[model samples]
Target: MSLDAAPGIIAVTLVTVATVAIGTWGLRFSRTTSDFFVASRTVHPRLNASAIGGEYLSAASFLGIAGLVLTFGAEMLWYPIGWTAGYLVLLVLVAAPLRRSGAYTLPDFAEARLGSRAIRLLCSLLVVAIGWLYLMPQFQGAGITLHAVAGAPTWTGPLIVGAVVLVNVMSGGMRSITFVQAFQYWLKLTALLLPAAVLLIVWAGEGRPRPDVDAAWSLPLADGGGIGLYTTYSLILATFLGTMGLPHVVVRFYTNPDGRAARQTTLTVLALLGVFYLIPPVYGALGRVHTAELASADALVLELPRLMLPGPLGDVLTGLVVAGAFAAFLSTSSGLTIALAGVLSQDLVAKLPQHRLSGVAAFRLASVVAVAIPCIAAVAVPHVSIARAVGLAFAVAASTFCPLLLLGIWWRRLTDVGAAAGLMIGFVGSGGAVVWTLSGGSEPPLLDALLAQPAAWSVPLAFAAMVLGSLCTPRRVPAHTSRLLVRLHTPESVPLDRG
Candidate 1:
């Protein structure tokens, strides 16, 4: 199972260089605060969609999905299924209205919709919290990838990725990284797509053996009759509903020119994600047949190429996957860093004395801090299943922001008090579950499952809180709610004051 490291090292180096080169080149187009924040909101559908795909296809998509499928079998497919369908949820319920809100960040949206600085501050806190939770796994995955690629130490990967992302995000902000990330999306696609094609040909030549699937692994839902169904549905709920709430993902909609462009971008992202997701399952199936005994399932994609091909050809393919893996870490990490930096810098600009720093300078400072915390955490904390770690973050987002976004946009009755109540309840409930699981506490089976996968209970609870709180304080609803709803739902052709 051992292989040469030169090819992987080269592949990773090239990807890193290309990412930095593309991002640096994009600096030419970035001049103002708008450019740094949202690419001046002029990105068209195709490009914005590509950037979103690049950012959205984290290590979870590139490596973790295949690993999960290899280890857990059919039931894990719900992750990608739910993740992709989440955008459809986003398209129907959120995209246009969110863009119409004309907010720079989710917190901005909350503040505007509720007309409360208090709610905005609360949203900002959750954004940073979720961003850190999501970003940590990326650093962890980088450590795993580099370790798989060249037997590098685990700590080295996070530091390298953190340094690279800090440079990229600090250089030109979202405008710069959008170009870099869009290019990475295609690289990631090619990384898995071509390798799968070659592997299938070899697989066909070798008589097309079926994957070794036991009865339990073959089930669509997992094991444990009632419990498995609950876990599967809980996972589906988290991934599907969580996509809209991810700060890195949600902020990209702000990069589009208008609501129509946002919708178009989402459609494009759906198509791109659909294509990319098809490849991981192929790797998983092949893993079952070829490299079933590998020590770490996370390295299944990396090792499978060499195990089957066994020559210069194998090394080349492994290198390509390595490139894709690094791209996954950089693109997603860059996006998360940009998102967190945006929220942090805005806080600085609003709260700090204006003469101390300008927006861009404030952003640079924030980017360093945003990247540093999780980078340190990745090194200090023991690595967990990369996919599971990401899912927990999604569960947190689903429970919290899912309610806020849905209720804020559709239910004009959503008052600040209600929004605040919902967010706190959601955050504490899901975040507590995450901490409990992470801290390695487990006893009763039902209780373990409930805390491990909190979305099922937490999401409904948050939604209920928001609804009840809003109903109880009816007069607290903003006076401008009706006009804002009209603007949010109205066609751009009508030419109302979008301001």
Candidate 2:
């Protein structure tokens, strides 16, 4: 399944140009710190939802899910389902409360609720860590997409994406990122939808012969038996709980005008994501019939168009998919960079030299650092399957921030000491699994399964540790805990004062 460089190059170029164009347009609306950071909290629900959908649908959704479904069949459907359901969890449990808290970043929420600079500092570090973990896969996926399409060198793709993201982020910060991401969502959806529609027509013309599926591939949770069940449930937990914890995702909630808008935004996001996710599995099912011999499953979406209709028509379809794929890299990376840069500037960069630096200047510097670290890692580290790398990030988030957010919003007894201890436990436990995965080693089955999917154990451990630690240090609970809980849980229509 070979492709011409001309179409891929043209598609990538167009997407890059459009991203810069939209970002530059947004620069007109971005003049102050609030504008850059939260678009002055004036974003409408539908627009905010589009931007969230754009940023949230990273390489994993754009390329990884279809590939996994193609490789693993029915069981892998859990991934996309889990990802979409995660927002459902967010809508019901977190959206309005998080917005009502009026914090720009996750650490902002932690410090505001707990009133402890120590917990804020810890939260800042984890945000940067998780942002980098998540960004690395987008970079890796970019390299894969470019190499599959234009036959570019592996390193070139990450470098290109990093540079593009830095430029977009440094141009106007979050305001620019919001516009760029919103545009990309429609771009990506159209890219996948058009190709799928065309392919379905071609398949129908050929009488739509059923693709052969073995019993193992046809049956969900039937492959690895007990281990498979554990892995599926573990994946479900990670994706569902992890959505609220992702820095790129959570930061967007702060861009809404009020708690009511925040809930509206989340509902729209669920609808948008549901629509976008439906297309990937189509590619996966079609892949079984065409391009089944391709070496990498991730390239199934990219290669299928060309293989099915190998001519000018096929080239056009492949080019559209490539554009969408590049959009995925840029949009998701830009969102992650903005969130990471916000934390870095506020927590680390601004703290230097007696805190004299201006907000925008500090943010620009942070943007570079945020994009640079992961860009370097993307090239240096050996590539894992794109979806698995992302899942590891989700595991880290699930273990650490999931408990923090759920408890901080719902329970008034959560002390700073408890939150900190839980974070460290999650970090060390999941962090060990990450190290093991990256280090490359043969291992016993039980240990291997445990390390490979750490969310099952690590998430529970973090929650338990927080509960126990809080119970032991009940006196250390913040004095403002009750007030904050009321503000978080109460509806905006209530007559009580929030701040």
Candidate 3:
């Protein structure tokens, strides 16, 4: 191998071996189906928090945010800010209530809250859709990272990640993945932090030269006038509201010991994410000063050390980043696979009478479905910026699940019929916009912009649909909603006949 290829190859090999090793170690603890699905609800708060941070910090955080920061300047910081703050929203609003509900997946929560199998089915499909959408970008980022580091074919990256994640998931399920993902959070943090520190030192030694970009690059909402402003706020809404709805994220809460543990995990995740996010923007700012001529802004972090230092040190930094990038792909892909697989096993695979799949068998089969579709789609679909694709996933999630979760937990008047209607309306509205945008049909500038970032409008429309529909059918509200609300809001320590 050439100088460029050897370090990348070594780093990737080590990361892969380490990941499989950690996963195998976790296998000993994963005996029952509950263990496979939620580690039997026994994971400690700190470890669970680390795993949540690992899985939640996807390709978008590792690669896409810096690219956006480089391209659009301060406005793009909203990506990371909204992402971290979303956990705050989860901490205060969703986490404890969700854990108290005792649902393994979003679909489980939907069914438990609304008492409707049809709604459960709809939530399952949405979970699958959002997981696939989110997974596609991780795979794409993998392709980009591998190509940058090792000069490999694009398809190889996604294929390698998909296969590794599938094996980790199938062998030991969530129990195994929990350990692997926790390790990855520290790995990713180390990967980004070391290079950023060295690069900042290098930048200072070179006399603190500023980027030669124009004034507009430093200003928020300076480009494209009204559309820029609209896009920024819409992105904010999507990410802030959307994080709670993500299937992979919600699945992690199920592993907590109880509602209080879930709350603690969310709080710790906010801290982990806050520290990790600070490093990416450093790459973006430094890239402008030193390496503006690179082909892709997304590659700026990987290329910066090499561009600035240009020898053994740069090469080593590249290797570390390559490992971190791959870790990002692996961790996020594993989490999504686990979440989607759970839904598939419970709602799809086991529902087939003739399949006769046992607990592990159904989950393994569902793992295949969860991993394969997105891997294929990643290759088939034209590559958008990884961050943009992730943002779209957030948009769909905010439109569909955010309203369902908020109203379901907080409102007694939220009827099953209303929830189903809201979900369908959100799905159709946001899903249609996603299809329209991805199909390469942007027109009538205003309409195109609205479709491109539909969250600001779609979210409210879904809420409105739910509220109005609930009012129209007030008699259909679940009789036990009040009691369930008490269970959700009350302290777990409080003695009551919850049953």
Off by over 4 Å in 3: none
Clashes of each: 0, 0, 0
Task: List lDDT for all candidates, in order.
Answer: 0.91, 0.90, 0.91
In terms of TM-score, how similar is model 3 to the real structure? 0.98
Give the per-residue lDDT of model 3 (tens digit) for 356-450: 98989999999999999999999999888888889899999999999999999999999988998898999899989888887785678779888
Candidate 2, position 449, lDDT = 75
Query: Which pairs clash inside model 2?
Result: none
Per-residue lDDT of model 1, residues 62-88, tens digit only? 999999999999898888998899999
- The prediction achieving the highest TM-score against the true structure is 3
Q: What are the models' TM-scores?
A: 0.98, 0.98, 0.98
Q: List the residue pairs that clash in candidate 1.
A: none
Which sections of candidate 1 miss by over 4 Å?
1-3, 353-355, 497-499
